[model samples]
Target: MHISDQEILAMMAIPQQREEAFKLLVDKFSQRLYWHLRKMVVIHEDADDLLQNTFVKIWNNLDKFRGDSSLFTWLYRIATNEALNHLNKKRTELLNSFDDLENVMSGRLDEDPLFSGDEIQKRLQKAILSLPDKQRLVFNMKYFDNLKYEEMADILNTSVGALKASYFHAVKKIEALIDNELF
Candidate 1:
């Protein structure tokens, strides 16, 4: 069953109803957020950590939430930021070379039992990994999650035109990578 945004907002407004409201929110959005993080981080454990962090942030900040954007978009913005921050931290700590970084992420993907994709999907994932962070985010949100450009723009705080260009470049780069067997 779907809860209306108005219902959620009403529930959140009362001190007594806040916990249940947040619980409903978590139940509704957690899996979507998890997959989004997993696609970017390529490791289930790391995704779990990022998901927890995202929820904690949400819980702490819900009272400050304005109704300017849909709750889904607001939640997505938080999740996206948490994932990006985690990735940036890992990159700084683990950097040796670009190829080395690719190998590490590829190894994680290969080791993930949760990943059931065949050869081509794996190759596509590797190609995706080779993209810059923003481009990879744009590609995943557009291609995998099927988010609308306006929705993505609200979450990414980027213009729709910029997101379109990013996705286009990301697709072209992935095609080239696949053709050359770079991943």
Candidate 2:
């Protein structure tokens, strides 16, 4: 049985149905959210850990969800924040430059057993890893997840025009990287 976001929110509002509602939410969104995190973090274990953290934040802040955005947008916002926070924290812990961090992430991708992409796919991912974090998020959301620019604007709290620009640049950069590597 598919429950609408409104129905989930209504269930969450009732004390008796809250646990069941939360469970339904996890069941519905977990895989989507996990892939979103995995794209950003590049390692399965880190993405899993961050997914757990995202849900924990969601559970704690359920009541704070004002319906200003759709439940999908709100959930994505929370998950995106968690992924960005995890990446930022990891970057700081490494005490290296972003370029160095990108190298490390590329190395992790090389070693990640969970990653089963072919040579071209690995090359594409390596190009993605070279992007600035926000640009990477924009590219992943648009290119991989197939999210609309408006939805990305809502989730990232940015303008649709800005997202379009970021995505354009990300694509250009990726294309350049791939072309350079191939030739």
Q: Please, what is the TM-score per model?
A: 0.94, 0.97
lDDT of 2 at 120: 90
Question: Which digits, one per residue and each the tens of the lDDT, describe model 1 over residues 71-135?
Answer: 99999899999988987888887776664666789888888898899989999998899998889
Off by over 4 Å in 1: 96-100
Q: Write the per-residue lDDT of candidate 2 for residues 1-183, one digit (tens) a residue.
A: 898888999999999999999999999999999999999998989889989999998999999999999998988888899889888888888885555679899998998888898989999999999999999999999999999998999999999999999999999999999999997
Which one wins on lDDT? Answer: 2
Q: Which ten residues in a row have the lowest lDDT in candidate 1?
A: 94-103
Q: Which has the greatest TM-score?
A: 2
User: CA shift at 173, candidate 2, in angstroms?
Assistant: 0.5
- Candidate 1's error at 6, in angstroms? 2.0
Worst 10 residues of 2 by lDDT: 92-101
In order, the Cα lDDT scores of the candidates are 0.91, 0.92
Report backbone clashes per prediction.
0, 0
